[model samples]
Target: MSALILKDFYVMWKQTKVLLIIILVFSCLPGAFYPTFAVIYAAILPYSAMAYDERSKWDQLAGMLPYADRDIVLGKYLFGYLSIAVAAGLSLVIQTALTLFWERASDNLSPLSTIPLAVCVGVCVLALTLPLMFRFGVEKGRLVMFLIIFLVCGSTGVLTGISSDSLDGGYYLSLALPAAALAAVVLTAVSIPMSLRMYRRRRA
Candidate 1:
């Protein structure tokens, strides 16, 4: 498991640094872009890493190696969590700094809501896509990824448009954010076994 994760990290080191830089820079920008980009970074890095694996035929190579199906799946999930944590932590720090220095920054943004929203969106999207990636490989699964993205964004737009007036209260974060985060976490949890099953079936 550790070896698998390290390999992923080695492959992802350059991309991860670039993403962190983007996250920091995006944090300095105005509006929801800060949190949104952080989540977007998390959503993107896993598939990018998978591209390296796919190109190298990691799946076939991994079969001959001692790596277990569950470990392979968990390694991918860990990579996603680690990437998300790094991006989220850095963004949170920058966001907090900007908040402290500017004082009225909250007037310009919605961190409480936005932070969890980003987590939910990013994590849930990744969770939704990864099992399919395991089953179909990244290249084949991208169509599904795009469809899911369209649906998610479209649904969000429709909800925002309809409930713009009602969702204004700060409590929405207190409510919606937790629910979304939980859903993301649950989905990710559920996905692990699904990915393991699919991956094992392929190898068999």
Candidate 2:
């Protein structure tokens, strides 16, 4: 399992520089403005990487080796998750630096609160995207991605419209964050077995 995961990482590492360039581009924007986009951007990495693997028929070759379907499915999912986690972390750092730079330029530098907000957005992205990729496979998952984007945007608008106070820091921390985390955990747990089954059936 570890070796399988390492192989996936090795393949993805070839594109690490491209991912870094993307992070750098997004990082140059204002933290408040960029974090949302960064979250969305990070969410696409897994789908893209999985698609690349499928396109190259790497999974088929991997299947013929000393590996099971579950191992392949889980390994790919973990690689995706780890890749996004790293990207999200770097995005947070970039956001912080940009925020600090802006504040210093205005001579009103105070601690920016965008770190947690970026993290929240990243969590939301992962919670929504990972399961879709796992359940549908990367090609079909693009539809799920579109639907999720629409739902997220519509839901955010509806929530904001209903009561702006719901988005307050305390409320977001106490309620929204925990709920998203729980959802992410459940989705990931459910998706792994589903992905394994799907891969087995496909291979069989």
Candidate 3:
């Protein structure tokens, strides 16, 4: 599983050097949404990795290798989880720097608070998308996944904005953070089994 994840990481680094640079630039920007976007982008990296795998017919190759089917599927999810963690960590650092050093900073952006929500969003997205990618090919799965993400993110953003305006910031964070984390955990637990089944079907 570790080796599989490392392979995906290597592929991602090779292909997304320029994209990472762009994400870094955006991470340093002023808006809270930028950090969230970075986390979301990181979550999707595994899907891109799967696209490369599909193009090269890596599943056929992987089946001939000694790795188990479960490991093969789980590695992709673990890669996504790791990517979200790294992105969220980076975003927190940037947010902290902005909070402490940026003189014109007006928003009450709590660095710690942003991480849970960003992670939640990223994990939820991966949980929803990965099984689809496993069952269908990456190219076909991505269109539907993208649409789902667009609607969810759009609605969530609007609701969050309304909540922030209506409630105390700390009060909202206190409620929202734990709820988001719990949801992510639940969704991930459910997603892995589904993905494992899908991969087995596809490989067969």
Candidate 4:
């Protein structure tokens, strides 16, 4: 399992370092966009890993290895989940640091309430995307993933507009964050079995 995770990381490090850096730069922007760091990366990194797998003809290459299909699928899901967690964790640290800086400078601080929302957004994006990629190869699934993301963002926008007038940010976030965490956990568990089945079918 560790070897599988490490393999994916090596693939990511080799292929995605530049893209990661490019995305990280945007994460520094002010306002509610901070969570985009984790969300965007979580949404992308697994697909990037998949592209590598396909390019390497992973089926032929992996057949001789001792690893099981479950391990391969689980490793990819773990990588995606952990990537988002790291991104969300980084955003938390950045938001905390920025809050301190604003206090010291006596500046009007942007609300940190969006941090949780960002975490949720990132997870939801993954919940929608990972299964599609697991069911279809990454290349074929990309369009559907984009459509899901668009609908999600659009739905979120509509919800925000409808509730913005009445609900306090704190109240909304407290509810949303837990729901997001639950959703992430559920989706992650389900994706693992589904991916395993898909991989098994391919092998057959």
Best by TM-score: 3
Worst 10 residues of 2 by lDDT: 105-114
Local accuracy of candidate 2 as per-residue lDDT tens digits, 7-100: 6666656856576567557655552344444444555565566777878987778867997777777676666566556656765666566555
Top candidate, metric lDDT: 3
Ranked by lDDT, the better of candidates 2 and 3 is 3
Residue 79 error, candidate 2, Å: 1.7
Residue 177 of model 4, lDDT score? 66
TM-scores for the candidates: 0.82, 0.71, 0.89, 0.80
Residues 78-177, model 1: lDDT tens digits = 8887777776676677667777787776555454346556656667777887888888887777797686567446534433332234356455555676
In model 2, how large is the Cα lDDT of residue 94?
63
Q: Which regions of candidate 2 are displaced past 4 Å?
A: 2-20, 104-136, 140-142, 148-170
> RMSD per prediction, one decimal?
3.2, 4.4, 2.3, 3.3
Model 1 lDDT vs. the true structure? Answer: 0.69
In model 1, which range of ten residues has the least summed lDDT? Answer: 155-164
Clashes of each: 0, 0, 0, 0
The RMSD (Cα, Å) of candidate 4 is: 3.3
TM-score: which is higher, 1 or 3? 3
Which regions of candidate 4 deviate over 4 angstroms? 103-111, 148-167
Residues 1-204, candidate 4: write the lDDT tens digits. 888778888988888897566546545555443345434445567778888888888857888999887778877767876776676666666656766786642242322455455555655666666666766776677786676557446644533443343346556666766876788678767766776777777667
Give per-residue lDDT, candidate 3, residue 141: 77
